[model samples]
Structures are given as structure tokens and as C-alpha cells.
Target: MSEAYTGGCACGAIRYEKAGAPIAALHCQCRQCQQRSGTGHASYVVLDRRDDLIVRGELQTWPVAGDSGNVKHNAFCPICGSSVFVTFEAMPEMIAIHVGSLDDPSCFHPGMVTYAARAQQWDRVGPGLKSFAEMPPG
Candidate 1:
């Protein structure tokens, strides 16, 4: 990686850093993600390992049942209510950082869309990309 990815919540209360290249980056249009983001979709950059992720200050987390039937944990700054990160109950080690929370949003390159079935017909992700009704098999 050229420069290490570093970012924090909108309030700067929670900060994190990641080493190594990202495992996968995607735009999720699932119903659960839409509800969480209050937008058309949620953009996420997934890193398989959680070793280098560092959190500073306090981050409030909420575990929500996802449409995929997985327990999803969402993190944000208690002060700003900014959605920061997400983790899965089954795969506790992986970190899914919100693209909006990144200081450099350019670092995110979404390659696919998840939960395509639930995506609104008018609100589409893009023209071309892999689309899955649910998370593709690992």
C-alpha cells in the first residue's frame, strides 16, 4: 500500500488505521444497509484482518439483525452519530469501514453491489458490477 489508510468518525472521537491492501470494497444496496445509512446504499471497504484497526475515544455500537440473517454490529461516535464501522457476529475479525468516514474517500473503489433484490428499481447502484441478492459465498 502507498499510504496507510487512516480515518475517524465525524466527531473525531473514534479513529482507526489499517495496514495491507483491502480484501474487498463494495456498495451495498441491501434493505438493512439502506435503513442504516438512510440513503440508497452503504459503501463499505472490507479488510479481512482486524489486527491493525485502532479505535480512539468512545464508539457506540449497535447489533442489528441483517436481512441476510447475520448479526451485524454498527459502530459510530457517541457524540456525532456518525456511522463508523461494522462487524459480523460470525466473522468477528473482519472490519467493514464506512467509506464516508474515511478522510480520503478516494481510497474507496466499489466493485459490486450486494442485496440487489431489495434495491429500489429507481435507485440503482450503477450500470455494471457484480450484483448479489445476498452476500456471495465466501
Candidate 2:
């Protein structure tokens, strides 16, 4: 078995352990991501199977419509107000955790940049990554 991925909120109010490897890691520059992260972009490590992730502690969640018109449920730590994870209404099996919430953020190796058209010039990622003007086709 692969080593588990462990992490939590800034104040340790919420914690999680993923038994499987991440399906993908990427940076999103959509307006919602920018606003939620209080930055030009937000980084996430996505897991294909929600069952692989075990989360503890109460998380506050809010629903927001994505550019695709699908509702995304954003989960955060109420104690520290740290954005922790997101679950999509359109893709219930998937779970995305913020890279900043990881115990070892170095494990994140972003493969792509989404919503590049909305990306701010000041928040540029490495030039070598694949970038899409919008979400890539699945």
C-alpha cells in the first residue's frame, strides 16, 4: 500500500487521511478559487475515490456554482477559517483537498493550470506546466 496522505486545517480543527495516492494535483485560477483562497489561484490535490479519504472533525461547508454550472461544496475549518476540501455535486466520487492544508505540501506536484484565462499576471506558475483556458475535458 502507498503511504497515506495526512493533513488538516491550520488550527488542526479538521484532519484527514487518504489511503490512496492522489489522482491529480493542479492550480485553479477561477474567480471562486481566487476569492476563496484570497489569492490569484488555489492549489488542490484531487482524489478519485471519496471513500479513500477519511476526515475527522466538523467542517463548515458552503455551496457555490462553478463555471460549469455544477455546485461545489466547499468545506472549511470554522475555528481557523481555513479552506480544507471541496466536493462536487456533479462528481460526488471526487474529493479535492487544498494543498496548503497538507501536512507535507511538498507532496503536491501540480500537473496543470486550469482557468488560465482568468489567471493574474502576478501569480504565474512555472512555464512548463500544461495550461487550459478553462477546465480540461475529462
The model with the greatest lDDT is 2
What does the lDDT come to for candidate 1?
0.83
Score residue 68 of candidate 2 by CA lDDT.
84
Candidate 1: give the clashing pairs: none
Task: Please give the distance, in angstroms, between residue 53's alpha carbon in candidate 1 and its true position after superposition.
Answer: 0.8
Whole-model Cα lDDT of every candidate shown, in order: 0.83, 0.90
TM-score of each: 0.92, 0.95
Write candidate 2's Cα lDDT for 2-88 as tens digits: 557789999998999886667778999999999999999999998878876788999899999998889999999989999988999
Q: Which ten residues in a row have the lowest lDDT in candidate 1?
A: 1-10
RMSD in Å for candidate 2, one decimal?
1.2
Model 1, span 20-118: residue lDDT tens = 578778988887788889988999988877776777888889999876578988998989888988998988879888999988999888888888888
Runs in model 2 deviating more than 4 A are none
